[model samples]
Target chain A: MDEKSTINKDSENIERGNNIEVWEDVVNIKDLLLSILICASAAMGGYLIAPDDPQKPLLYGLVGVVIGFLVSSMIIKPKRTLRFEDEEK
Target chain B: MDLSLIMELIAISIFGAVLYTIIGIAPGTDETAVLMPVTLILVLSGLQPISVLAFFISSIVAKKLTDSIPVAIAGIPGGVLSAPMVEHAMVLKNRGLPDVSIRKMASGSVIGTLIAVPLSLFLANLLIPFGETISKYSNEIFFGGAVFLALMTKNRWLALLSIVPFALLIQGLRHLYWGTGAVPEDTTVFTSFFLGITVGPIILKLLELLNKEIRSNLPRRTTNDIVLKQQEKVKGFPNPFKILDKKETGSAAFSSVLGVFTFFMSPAGMTIFLGEVISSRIKDPIKKATRAISSMDGVTNAAYISGILIPLIAIGAPLSPTALGPGMALFNAPPVFTEDHNLHHILSMGDFIVATVIGAVIAISLTYFVTVKYSQQICTFVFKYIPHEALLGVFLALVIMLAYMDAGLINIGGVILIGLVAGVLHRWGVNYGIQFMVLYAAPWIVGNLVF
Candidate 1:
């Protein structure tokens, strides 16, 4: 009975450890670039088709999309920090 | 007004509200995005404009109410409008009052909507003529809006600096197409807005993912316990207005007034400002801040819908992004359709009212059920079942598809490159909103100066 209980405890520890390992492995540079590309392309397309005016919504959206991307990638990503503090760091 | 029409209006309101709620609860969907597709379909249906208006009104209201759920339970905001709710909901969560607070908010919103409808419509009747006069100076209004934006943001100098680049980018693109004056026969002018919204973000994220060894890692959040706890906490009857602590009432009233202006400042932007003002006005910092956030969400949603009535009736423009859905639809419809005489014209007015009313009602109505029955379970289910990488992948595909549809594949490719370039600039802490303001306003500014 003691051995059986010990085995169960061992398995649970393994499971928790695996979960943490999996979580740590998830975020990569490739996924980040893909997101940036998706957003920027969206902005460019927006610039192309929005109501015809200067200070174009599309153009501004493009800038926003790009800014959001770069801040996340160059500054936010480099520090390997989580949360908003990474940007400041 | 019409009894038979009233029934139809209610039906549309209910349907619109449900759809809006669905979109609102789900992250990453915008009000404009949902309304745009529906508007397109309604236009094709050849239904009277009034019917379409009903759908618009109902949908907007529903969206406002349901959007708070995700923000309240998880940290995820429903849309741009529901962003303020995140902070408030977090406070409520920490205090073990998330359910009670949200229920009150839902109630307060409904009451606020009830108050806002007649009041705004009355104001709309009075202010529409003024809107007509002001709209004539679109350029001047744009300038004012830009200045307002500069004042509103963190670091005014940075905001001002951001405007120049946005203007250059917008003007350069427009000139590229029209300057050649070789008008491409079939190229649609409105495609750019759709493209910008869809592609710009996707490209930036894609680049980030590619550079890192890490994959997508989103947080796991659930609201089941909070919701169940809320159910157990409320004893007797639920008074929706209980959420509107004494101070919140005045803040809600004040926010209603701010929402009416047609300047290009985002609804979200104004709400944050209004929230700050209300928080300052109250004596209790905690309640003051929470109420301020609540009132900001309520007023922004109401004012955004109700305020547009002025521009739509007076000038042909609908100032709010949500209202733009119907206005753009109106423009795309037959030109012969008389502005006042058409059913669509009448429905547009009705739509504003319906959206306001339904959004408030549904939000209030659902708060209890959401808090008691499904909030925690639903949240838990989502976190447990949904994978972040899969979610990102799907959204990425959607963003790409939307961009491609807005322009062509070539434009899509160009947008990806542009996003990367823009992302680089963003790292330097450049202001995108100012850039956008410049993009549209620069051409006119330069034209005014040069010509």
Candidate 2:
């Protein structure tokens, strides 16, 4: 089944080009760079925009992390496929 | 404690348990890298000390319980702690009993949590009288720990030789930060450098990816296909005692007790050692593998809990590898939790017990059930929706922001430089344990080097 998927799916991947694997999962390089930029800018933005307080900038930056994670999650479709088999008994 | 505070602790524990349960199943999330950032954020956000303690304990328990299930489902380990059990888990997976691996490992985790919490707290109480002595000599102790851990590594000579030089690099960076007035002289610029070590390998990897020649030669994959073995739905709340056989339960409990005692040593190392010793007498392949995974899971969980608890209760500093890595924020998030005034100084003995009990019980019950009953479903959701790039991006962004917060724009370059050097040393087999101890003892080692 795995071989069949790879052979049959190579045509689509050649065009879609989401073929790179990183940290035990598949990711396109362009998307990864875009996500990093978006997340980092947002985090820095949140930190710079915060009221001058010891904890508030850090809090806002953390909130920005969540927002960036959400945006990236929505825009990027995970490049993984799942199949389930009956337990071998 | 106020009723509201107690209620808040419970709520935070639930949130931590639920969150870590999902994070645990997501393969390849390193324990330190993922855990430290979140806990640091919580500490810096000004949560009450006890609430942060409860959340952290709950997260570790939940993380330990669910991390190994990925090994059963796929050949992949969920985190560094689970990496040792992969070989044993593969034995079961090959024999068509993958779900059995999940049940035993998770049950072992529950048992470990039960044994370690009380044992660790009790041990901490016995050591309280000596806490001051230990605190006074923390620098010497940390330097000693770095040497001890370095000698224990596979590349001992390389590890040993790297320690002093690494200490110099760390101290040199801080001195530069201070001399340039990038940060106030009193501030230590610790959190970002700590984070740099955790993010080091990624920085190296990302740079390599940018090289056209290296990129061309790198392994390419169209997709990451995950195959799952369907598990039977567990009826009612699963009982750990019933899930593990008598012998498995006995070995897991015994190893866990030892794990608590050896909290200062590497948990992964102890897990591999104790698992083999305990399971060596068993002859049957299936039985031996099962025993190994169960016992290994127990040791990993117990060691982690003890590593966090003993230091938090007995000493305010991070004296254990587990404490120094994932639990670093608890001891020294700076401004929020300084070595002199963290959880150890804030919470009473009774408060520690209450927070721990709530955290451990909630995590065991919730994560054990989810891991045993619906591992396949959880794995599916994470694989389908959670992109690895986003996780990496968030971690990278968090490190950058924290670096900026530490000193200013100039310190970002300092962190990247630290990350590059750390990455090279790490690739040379200098483990994180030695590196973290060096980080703790850097100023001392560098200061004492003066003629």
State the local distance difference test value for candidate 1.
0.51
Query: How high is the lDDT of residue B385 in model 2?
Result: 76
Query: Which runs of model 2 end up more than 4 angstroms from their true locations?
Result: A1-12, A15-18, A87-89, B1-9, B19-52, B66-105, B242-251, B266-296, B321-346
Q: lDDT by residue for model 2 over A1-89, one digit each (tens)?
A: 57855753665376355357664456788879988988898889898999997668877887787788889989876666666665324
| Model 2 chain B lDDT-worst window of ten | B375-384
User: For each candidate, how many residue pairs have backbone atoms clashing (under 3 Å)?
Assistant: 98, 0
lDDT tens readout by residue for model 1, B70-102: 566444555556655566666665454545455
Give the alpha-carbon lDDT of every model: 0.51, 0.83
State the lDDT at B135 in candidate 1.
Answer: 57
Q: What DockQ does each candidate score versus the true complex, computed on alpha carbons?
A: 0.05, 0.57
The 10 consecutive residues of candidate 1 chain A with the worst lDDT sum are: A76-85
Top-TM-score structure, candidate number: 2
DockQ result, candidate 2: 0.57
